[model samples]
Each structure stands twice: as C-alpha cells, then as structure tokens.
Target: MKNVIEDVTCAGCCCVCDHIQVTTDGQQIIDVQTTCPQGQAWFAQSRQTEKQQPLIKGIDASREAAIARAAGLIQEAQSPLLCGMGQSAVDAQRAAISLADLTGATIDSGASAATRALQQVGEANCTLGEVRSRADLIIYWNAENLRFNAHHQQSLVPPGEPVPRKIVTVGSELPGDSRGVDLSLTVSVEDEFEILWRLRALLKGVALEGTTAGELASLAALMQQSSYIVIFFGPASPDERLFHRKLEALSLLAREIQAERRCHTINVPAAGATKGAEPVLAWQTGYAAAVNFAAGYPRFSPCEYSTVKMLEQGEADLCLLIGEDPLTGLSDQAIQRLQQIPLIHVGPVPLVDLQPEVYIPTGISGIHAAGSLYRFDGTPLPLRALISTQQASEAEILNQIETLLKPVMHIC
Candidate 1:
C-alpha cells in the first residue's frame, strides 16, 4: 500500500478539471480517484502491454531507431509540414516553430485555418471575460450538450440572488438540468434553416414564410426579452462555413436588437484554445498564408492552403504532428495520406489507430508539463507542473530534435 495519496489536476481535455486524485506504489501508479472515464483512460495504461509500444512502418522499433529515422526524414524532405501544436508543451510548440523556421516548413496548430477566421472576427468583438461577466442572454446553437467538453459551463451562471438572465438553447432540446437558469427555450434542429430565416425576417422587418406561427411567436418573445446576448455554436460537423454564415445572420439580428436594447454576440467553436490564441498570433505575425508561404513574398487566401486540402491532394511528404489526435478527429482521406507520409508525432498518444512511423510521446501540456495555455477568454494561463516523473519532458526532446536537425538543414 502506498503511503501518499495525492489529488492531481487533469488537463487532458478543455475542461481542465483540477480535482483528480491518485495513489502510487513506489514508481508504479496503483489507483486514481475523482476522475471521469476519459481522465482515467488518459492517465492509466489499460492494455496488457508490459513495455512501451513503439512502431515504425507498421513494425516495432527501439526508441533510438525511431528518433533517428524521424530526424532523417525531416532532413531529406523539402516541404515538411509541422502541424498540430495544441496538445504538446509550450516548449515543444516553440521547438516546432524553430523546426519550421530551420526547415522553411509550415508550422501550424489544429484549426489553424478556422483560428485565422476567428481572429478576424475577434478583432471587432469583446473578450470572453467581458461577455461572461456582462452578457445576460446565453444562447447555444447546434450545441447538443456542454456537460462533456466544458462541464464547468453551468457554473458560469451567477448564483445566489436572482440576476435577470435568460438562457435560451436554439437547438433540438433544452438541457435536462436547469438549476440556475431563468429561461430554457428549445428550437428544432431539423428546421434550423427556418429558425434562422424567422430570426432574420424579424430583424429585417421582412415577411415570414412559415406555418409554425406559435413557435415563431415564442422565439420572438425571447428575442424581445433579451437585453445582452451571447451565442455559442458547436463545430461538431464539417459545415463550419455554413455555421459561420448563420452566425453572421445571428449577429445581424443582434445588431437590430441592439438598436432598441443593449446586446452582444459570438460563437465558441470546438477548438476553444486556438480561437483565443490565433487572432493575437495572426495580428502579431500575419495570416497563415503569410506564415506558411514558401515563395519570396507573403501571400494571403482563405481557400488556398488548408491542411485538409494539402493532405488530400497527396501534396504532403513529411508530417510533424504536434498536438492533435489525427487518428480520430481528422477525415479518413486525410488520415490515409498521413499514414503514407513520414509522420513524427509529439505529445500524448491519442486514443486512435495511429500506427505512426515515429511516435515520441511527450509530457501532457498544462499538467505534467509547464507552459502557457490560452483560456477561452483570450487570457493566457501559465500552467506549472504539480509533480515530477520519469518520462523525458517534451521540451527536452524538442530541443534535441532541433539540435539534430540544425546541421542537416545547414541552419545553425
């Protein structure tokens, strides 16, 4: 039995739950406490594998061999793409940035493209802190539930005295539990288009064309009642562009509402961290087009250089995966291309069919590793390590890789 039982923090997901507890027997971990299944699986080794799994070209290899091969691939490739920097330590991320500079490669995080767009929108918008503190109306569109991703979302509601706030869910159903909310309105997910159309019509003084008069009246009543509003949209599907268009329409509606009453609006997409970080990074740097441009001058275009398209066309030869779980989240086509290429992965092993050519597992950012992580509100939090372990830290590995790659690229 272990003498010391400690409450450890979990930063595996966006929720950043700090109530995790664990007990270790000497060097081996024995028990975990207060953690959800996701957290437990993330920290515990479930498989009956005695040794750390290492593979190359669908075959097993020693850690040294894997590292050497990965380095060689990067040295040879002309346009190596250093992608997915969100999950790794800040040091690893910086190392990736350095690698990109040395290799003249494209370095980007997951949602690099979407973040570009969000940054543009954010320049004209208020910070999330301001919204949470001030906004009275909280509207969620196409967001099935927040309990999974952002469990603490419910706590955003002001407790104790009844502050006049309206919580309207513009999706299929209302939340099963609405303790602190004053209003819980539901809209149909099937006729989302009609809902938007009705909202737009009401805002523009245009004639409505729908048979659901009662529903329309109810929506109108909520709209009129709201004083300060904030909309949250989930990017569960690939129809993000369409969702953005709908959000713009919603924003227009908010503007019209603001003409008579004070109001604000925004959409919190799935990649919340990048959403907060990208705009500033872009403004400080430039659009990704400029950042990733290989030619003499910087270029900018939305449709041109997305990761999905780049990988789909079989254009990428060398891939340096940073923070994302490519095996699960990415499209199958993209995954196929990734499998074909010389892939170098750094960070936590994603729960998916990786079969990576070189997988150098790094310390978990914001938890096992110390670094800066951007909160949903654009606030940068400096995460410090609460405990130390045997694993080689991400920052050290990144430094080593960068050093090894320097002479190969003739960039000291």
Candidate 2:
C-alpha cells in the first residue's frame, strides 16, 4: 500500500515550506509535490546508499560494541568537542547537549559569527508572513538568490499587489532584469562598510561635506517614502574580516529607520545542517553557539570554542559530530586537522572522505524520522516521517549515547 501524506514540510532548506504532499511506499518515498528542485532532490534522495552497520575503526562492529566504544572514547578524552547540532532535530540536540555536559565537551552550532552578531547587537526581525503581506518595500542587502528560497519571490511579491511593491538591492553583486528589482546600488566589497555607515549617518540628518553623503541620500529618500521596509541580508563573504562590524551597521541602520518608518533587518542563510541551531542553543544554554560545558555549565566563547578554532589549534582530542552538514566550508587545514583526531559521528555519512573512528548511520529527519524544523524566520514547523526505516533517528542515537555515559560519569 502507498501512503499519501498531506501538509508535509520540506527540510531541504531553511525556508521550511510546510504545504507539501508526499507519496511514500512502505520502504521509500515515491513522490514529493508542491516543493522546489532542491526539496525534490532531498525528498527522493536519488543517490541511495546501502544500509550500513555500525563501524569501529573502519571495521564493521555490532551496534552494542559501537556504542560502547563511543562512550569509552567520550569518557577518556580530555578535551572533547561536540559540533554539528545545526543538522539534527530539535529533540535530538538536547540529547547531544546532555552528553556534552556529562563529558565536559564543547558544542559548536556552526552559527558562531551570526550568533555573536545577534548577541552584540540584536536584530529587528520579522516573519515571512509579515514580509509578504505588510511590507511595502523590500531590500536585499548583500544577499543573492534570496537565500536560495525558490518560493519566496512569488509568495512575498504576489501579483496584483495594491501598490506594486518596490524592490531594492544593495551589494557588489545585484540581480536585475527578470528579478523585477526596481533599484540597484552598487558598493565595492572593500567599501561596503563605509557606505552602510554613511547611509545611517545620512538618515540621522548628520551634515556631511563630501559627494559620498549625497550618494547615500537617495537610499535614505527611498526609505522615507515607505511605510514598512524589510532588509534581507545574506551570509557575509568569507573575505569579509569585518563581518561583525558590518552586521552592527546594518542592524543600527534598520533601528534608525524604525524611528521614522517601520523597518526591520534579517539574515536567512540557505537551509543546511546548522540552519536552525541557534534557537535551541539560545533557549538551552542562554547563548546561541560556540558554547563550552567543560565547567559543567555552559559558557559562550565564539572565537575559542568554535569547531574551526578547535580543529585549527589541535585543541580537541575527540569530536562528536551529531548533524548532517558533514562540516563543509571549512579550511583545508581544518579538514586535515579533523582527519587526525578521534571522530565519533552519529548522524548521516559525512560528504567528505574522512573515515570515522566510530560510525552510527541515522535516518534523515523529515524523511525517515519525524521532528521539528525551524524556518528562516525562526518559526518552528512539524516535520513528518515519509517512510519506515530500520535505522535509528539522530535523536535516538544521541539519547542512547547519553544514557550509556550517565552510569560512568558524574552528572550534576
């Protein structure tokens, strides 16, 4: 028999479109409708891997032995770090954090830079629903492809809008022509920071003596004409060393505009492993990411506790990867450093080719296991299981690991 599930949510990206319909056979997903190209690929999962058994040191082992070896490693390591919570389910991350507490391990959510920016200077945020219905003007700032949300353009800028919504873009790379963007202001990569700060000053009526001030007035004039404006920011470039400062400037600019017109700014990165990791961390640890529990209490340190920093400095003795991202976008040196460590991975097979010391394959969330996934706006949605699988879920694997370690370690 085939089951046609309704109102299914797509975990393909951070967009988290919740109005999908999925057709699943007893063993695999047959069809997924009302989703994007990425979601379709994620739902069907064309590249099928054979069922894997738990492995220890490149050698297949019993599930019991794999868990025992993993617990033993966690117990023996002096400086263990648990990274990759962004790829797991909400219920699963708690288990990972509990295990970290028991073993005095640090956890990185991969949102270290963004979390730090939010903590330093909070963002004026709005939901996708509000942006679609209420916003009269939309600004895409240093953002490309609107964070890879294929459905956002149609949903937000629907046809027959009363006022013909104005679209504005600011960045070195701006999309035009068919995107229907009305305005494009170009800023050099090196000068983006100065331009944003100058615009904020211009909005404040601060007198300026240069042509740069005149150039900024046009954007300010646009802002003054709109009743509701929302700025969508993409991830900072890897070359942007002053990312935090730029975020601060953008946030303050939104805040400044809010005094006169309702204005908001947001960051909606593409959906991936660490997509919604910040919410769980903020609620559980009082900080968003780059958290350490070595003292048996959570401590926030963006620079020190980051997974990249730990690998780069060779500070971590053991790594417990608990999500599906596989640690992509890391420097080659960091990737090479991870190869040298004792790795205990409890989720999907990593994309990179580093063999693990202990491997426990898990069913993909929203495909074989049900859980909660957060949208880009931090709205939590129900993720339904589309097929039956013998493999355990990420949450189950992490919980089992935590349960095994409780008897051996002291948990205060």
Which stretches in model 1 have alpha-carbon errors above 4 Å?
Answer: 1-9, 18-35, 45-54, 58-64, 119-133, 147-150, 157-162, 172-198, 211-217, 239-243, 250-284, 288-293, 296-300
All candidates' lDDT scores?
Answer: 0.56, 0.77
Error of 1 at 8 (Å): 5.7
Error of 1 at 275 (Å): 6.5
Residues 1-412, candidate 2: write the lDDT tens digits: 8989888887777677787888877777788886488778777652242266789998988878888899889888999998876657788887787787778889878777787778888988988888888888888877666633567675575445564578788778765543667677877777878888888877778766665565567777888889999888777665344677778888888888888889888786743433657888889899888889988799998789978888889989999887666575456777888889899988755445778899987788888888997777778888777777777888888888888888778543
Candidate 2's error at 98, in angstroms?
A: 1.5
Q: Estimate each model's TM-score.
A: 0.78, 0.93
Top model by lDDT, which number? Answer: 2
Error of 2 at 56 (Å): 1.6
Score residue 190 of candidate 2 by CA lDDT: 77
> Could you tell me which 10 consecutive residues in candidate 1 have the lowest summed lDDT?
45-54
